[model samples]
Target: MVDRLFRMKTKSIFVRLPLLFIFFDAVRCDYFPTLYPRESETREIKELNGLWNFRADMSVNRSQGFEEKWFMSRLEKTGPVIPMPVPSSYNDVTQDKSLRDFTGWVWYDKEFFCHYHGKDRGSYTGTVYWMITTNSEEAKVQVEVVDADSNTVVMGEGIKGQASVSNVKLWWPYSMVKTGAAYMYVLKVTVKDSTSASTDIYRQPFGFRTVNKTNTQLLINNKPFYCHGVAKHEDYDLRGKGLDMVSVAKDFNILKWLGVNCFRTSHYPYAEEIMDQADQQGIVVIDESPAIGLLQQVYNLTKALDPTRLVTFASSNSNPLSDHVMNIVDVVMVNIYFGWYQDTGYLQTIPYQVPPTLEGLYKHYNKPVMVSEYGAETLTGLHTSPSFTFSEEYQKDLLIQYHQEYDKLRHEYLAGEMIWNFADFLIDQKTNWAYGCNKGLFTRHRQPKMAAFTVRERYQKMINETQKYQN
Candidate 1:
């Protein structure tokens, strides 16, 4: 499998998908991929992902687990046991449908071997970090790092926090530093046993990396990074939004193939595992919240969890609300569908429409602006005379115009331009929808469309031009 995966290059960027499934399959553990080290601390990250001892209190009326301190692992033998897979939804794992829907407190238990070696054992330095997620306001979650004697090493409240300790390790991505091996630590997430607590403890394994921004560019570990990828959606047949490792690995491989360096989680945040994989591959992700009905609180939370990246809402239209929201964000982004959805489908219209939108944003906000999305839906193999909607030639030509206009503006005010999607994906079947939206550079199964080559060539040229000017 390792030999089957090869490398592709475009100018200076070396693109390769390091297939780690060979080791992942053997160990049955998933690595949580957040770069959490603040440079002052070295941390050890362990993904408690495989089979965990699970007990679901379906009674919908019990609360004794919290009062009795069930999170301490002392009550391991107090309930019926079933081996549950970590990093998976507990809904479809059982034969009983009620168990799938049973929303009470589900207890998960796992023990991992931790090694601490220091001559001065009293001053060991380490920290335990994990992400705690919940859907209900009434839900209560707690985490504890315990020793063999059930002594609490550290404890915390809320969904995601870090508990500092002594004598630990640091995680590095394969792309960042190839150490030939990866190390991790263990974490336990628990909740109160009650009808109100419909809880699932997910396994998160993150490493140490820092994200921050400059006036004109994004900085990873203090180095400026230019995003050159597409807006991606979590849509696939059969699985829908369910976590499928195969599709994810394929997506990473395709992103590498494009020679692009980054992508935004379009519309919403992606699965934790996907973020982990992105971390492992060193792919920069512009994590987004929901499109509409979204609150500033959501962006606040995302920024709080990952402070290295900026949070900007994708504004489609110019309005007071959007203008007000953009004022509050770290960056300004707009999703314009002009020349396809609004204006005439003419290339000349693009130059007129795009520049003013960006210039207006720059004038008012004085923040870096990016074209988050801009594309026309084009069906594969379809052609048209003047480049009409749903035609491959139209999609190709429309992108060509948009890119040309963006090139002229990017140097001045625009920071990046992410095409609507990398691939055509599953969508709700409706009257106006043609099978699925064909606005992708590739088909749903990862087949390249005409626009794919167009994008690749344009990206390569852009990189070469930037390099020449920089030199």
Candidate 2:
């Protein structure tokens, strides 16, 4: 859920030695896990989505689990255990108040039966290629293309491939043009071995889209695109970061109702299931890596691996004029809290301060600029007439100010604007966090505040304007 740096302290002097060794070793490690798991004809997947035995390390030093080797045996054997959901956060599942605020290693145990099949084993080699099939009613065509890594593949190796489809339907954001739907094509891959008479087939669904950027515009499929979006986190009431299909469907439905076209996975990559829904719903995603604070290295490595998509990091620095990494990024994304954090209660100064900052960043970098984050924290059901801080009115008024500034710069260098949050989420208790950050346009339960209506109106207007222009 929340991103925070952890520092382990102990009386032992050898702790630093192993940590330092790990730090250096990690720099040399280049292998990264597959982003998403898939099932093919030859490969099978089992869902581990039910209850599991759970226990938290409540010892004084919080190292009792490691000392007792709790993972080696059932959690109930070591002590009394509770049933916790596998993909959910362990914090908010019980009645104990201490468990809700626990910050230590938690152990989980699950038992499942897997049947092993014994077949004739031999050296297996295969040729893998891609077949693109159109699933639309208006068009039905299939084309075969060679894999980028060529046709040859060993038994345990993965192959990379790409193909071009002619007369393809482009993936568009929600209601961008003619109430467009997310058009995706099936990429069927077949691996065949002539000797073993073994074959594997996998079908991957992907949308045919291209992203580009000019000095003052962000283009999707070579058409100018605007992001009337929000930054989101995977937090829920009792489920926390758990994978719940009901919640996922509800969130996507609300996003459509709000006329939102895009969203950024605030500080890290989201669950693959959420991404699948994004593709199906035609929502643009600004996918982010985990928050490690190495933007330049992340940019370089990601660009080197896949140079097709535009890459940019969200800058929280108030002063963008002196930002050092602006030149290396594809777009300038700044999380400016002009009225909320900086000016603090001075809502009138937002218009004066925001425009100059955006202009400065655009002129300096000569790239498209975006206000990736801007919002005020307002408690649900709290209201004040004159737009005082911590009131719903203040939050609504602050967003209006930011939108005013965005409109002035939209056609020039401002490419997009995304509010700070889509909904309220859980975080560690702190001085500023009342339960958690209340900056969301909607509450933690997905109930809209007054600001949500404002955003919806503005976004719908933008969509209508874009549609008219395209026509």
Candidate 3:
């Protein structure tokens, strides 16, 4: 396990939510439905996405605590309880504004009833399906959906076998079923640490969807299509997950108006409501992991070439091992900050490969891997020397560098790319790097920067310059 030192960044977004237990207000908005219809695929899903239990473990308690049997046993005896909510960060339970620091290990659990009325039109196999997910390489945990209301346990099984084992029954997008029927599916996630355990269980809705990527393309129902999608943020001005349905619904309306055929959840996963609206709108999703803002220092590649590193698959699919369970491209959103920061030579790290690693993640996960959000930050740092300045010469070179790099993978592995941003939004303004100019194809309001026109012309040309094959 890579040990990432947990330190709250001086300016982080987690600090937005207020730490307080306010009375649960009463304003009834319909809960997001988890199921829809797909003519050639499965439908009907239950979304287990409501209140869930949560807890975070400090690192010190884990690494050193793992060696002591008594200490480990003591933690297992009483699982830690953090907070409970649906589809938000685990820090929802604490006052630690920066959920980044609470990263060691966390847990979530919930309970529900099961109901799989009967197989659909064909291949009617009578069997129950259970699915679980976590961050640990290998986890030992059990989930039980018991009906204490009726004094009976419906589904109670420990999940600790392998990655494929967990993929027993996968959900495909617009193919198999739109949703999974859960009369009541409760969840209990126990992310075990050496001497500390974080467990969260609660009632929420969960519907399964299977996604597949193939033939340098992607399909929702075995149909080839181009996904004109955007990586969206929660709400431009809302604080925390403090979004209202009216706002979410409005975004959906905007998407429909814009003629978007797909939606990628950017770097992080999103709330259940967002997924429901997308499915309903027939918008395909690249559904990326919860990662963004690659503002970091770069390191030099060790001169010694290690074959192991060369052959490892770079599937950024939050769950590297869940390959069998869900189709997700492990995309590396290469930005100037994420890797090889200061090293001007690091740009040569293209065609990065790890042996026969799925040839490419899109093929492996049956999904197109996108450079969803990437571009040289216009203002990573200012001109240091007398002649150094943020000039068109510098910008042209920087833009052309990444464009040329990804261009090689065009017919090879990559699906497409979305520049760091379309326009400088509210978030960029908050960053220290913002000095009127930063990451954006357009200015803050909506004016296209010179680079914007370049992106349009280059991208449109790529679209028009497709090579046709003859057998």
Candidate 4:
């Protein structure tokens, strides 16, 4: 059976499809590529991705004081419980979608004291680090920083304040060159009870890499590199969209096989392992903040916070109606995201989000920005085909207009924009006018919806024509 499968895949019709399947299959799940030299660094990483014990409380106010140096001293012995994962969120893995939907206060506690030792029996100087994420603090309170940065936190309050760490190894991404299979890293998170009679603690295995965007371009160690890549969503087979670690691994392997050097996670940030693999393979990545624009209808107070300036993220080959639709939508997306900027009084006053969003992203792990996903889908061009959208006489005039607007902003401000999607995807929802049109540069099933070659040609020209090196 295996021999027959190999023969079929070897045929031209099967072509890259079989390799694609294998690549994605391997990267998506926890498995090896059968043969290849291993990296010692890869084995060094201890992945802490799994079900973590959890508890959620909406009424109890979590301590914001944890932000201070004197925060980690608190500890509690009992609570109503559930399951969560380190490097994960309550928004995922919840059986009751309703509980997952509402973001209040979520508390997770896991007991893991590192089994792997560096040197001494129990005297080695180590640290406990955490990646703390909170839903929305407006309704509740939580801490959101990797716990290692919060070492030796002293308690200012009772045991109500708590943080967690798990024992795990560093993760591997398809970073650069011959990345060793083993990772040279460690992570620790410990909360001490100076006020209590005992040493109350929680620990985890972890490591850190600094990501910062610099100059006019993005860089990891100190070099500029463009993203050769694609965007990814969490859907395949039957596991659905939950943050399954095995699935993420399979997907990573797929990208590696495609010779993809970079990827922008559409809509929201992806699993921690995704980034870890990027680190291993030197794959450039844009870990975006979660998508909140679509939540417009979910919240009543959204429109009032149209704080960021939407300077028209138009396309170069945009059509008119599409332009108008995009002009309106960019304003909405800006409103939702920049609302935080406005609330903090940092909108136009500082080139903060624009420069630093790129810079900050590149700073930790150097990689160029795709600005990856942006723009909207136009319903006006449903009749037009893909290649013809930019054929000089396309029915869709608005598509070009959007790119034109987007191009004007290019320079040091943004690197490259993959522009939302190459095609539409299935969401099983009525939100996309019977299809998720807003996401497609092309349509579902790989059809060149009305914005295909138009985008590709223009972007290619921009790359070919511009001597960006002169700057």
Per-residue lDDT tens digits of candidate 4, residues 257-316? 334455666556677756655654455665544334533342223334333211122222
lDDT of 2 by residue, 1-471 (tens): 111122222211111111001221122223324334455563334566645566788999988877887665545678866555556766644545688799877777654333212211122222223433433333323324322112211222224344444434566665566643575555545454434332444546665566898899999767899888999999887888877865776687678778889899988899998898898778899998864568778887888776776988888764655667778889999998978889899989988999998898888888999889999999999998888998999999999998988999998999889998999998999999899989998899888899999998998888789878764
Best by lDDT: 2
Native-referenced Cα lDDT, model 2: 0.71
lDDT of each: 0.63, 0.71, 0.40, 0.38
Worst 10 residues of 3 by lDDT: 14-23
Model 2 ranges off by over 4 Å: 1-162, 196-198, 291-293
Off by over 4 Å in 1: 1-204, 291-294, 303-309, 319-322, 460-471
Clash count per candidate: 17, 0, 54, 98
**Candidate 3, 1-471: lDDT as tens digits:** 111122222221111111211111232223224433222333234454544434444556644323332222223223543324555554432324555356554534443333222213223212234456655645545544322222223345455331111222222322123332111222334455444453434443322333344646543323333433345555343343345444454455444433434555654567876775565445566554432222111011211232111111122343335543233212332222221234433434422422123244444554444555544445433343321224333444555666676566555655555555544445444454554335655444334455655665564454233211100
Candidate 4's C-alpha lDDT?
A: 0.38
Residue 424 Cα positional deviation in candidate 4, in Å, after optimal superposition: 5.9
The deviation in Å at residue 374 for candidate 3 is 2.1
RMSD of candidate 4 to the truth, in angstroms, is 20.9
TM-score of 2: 0.67
Root mean square deviation (Cα) for candidate 3: 20.7
What TM-score do all the candidates reach, one by one?
A: 0.58, 0.67, 0.35, 0.35
**lDDT, candidate 2, at 328:** 82
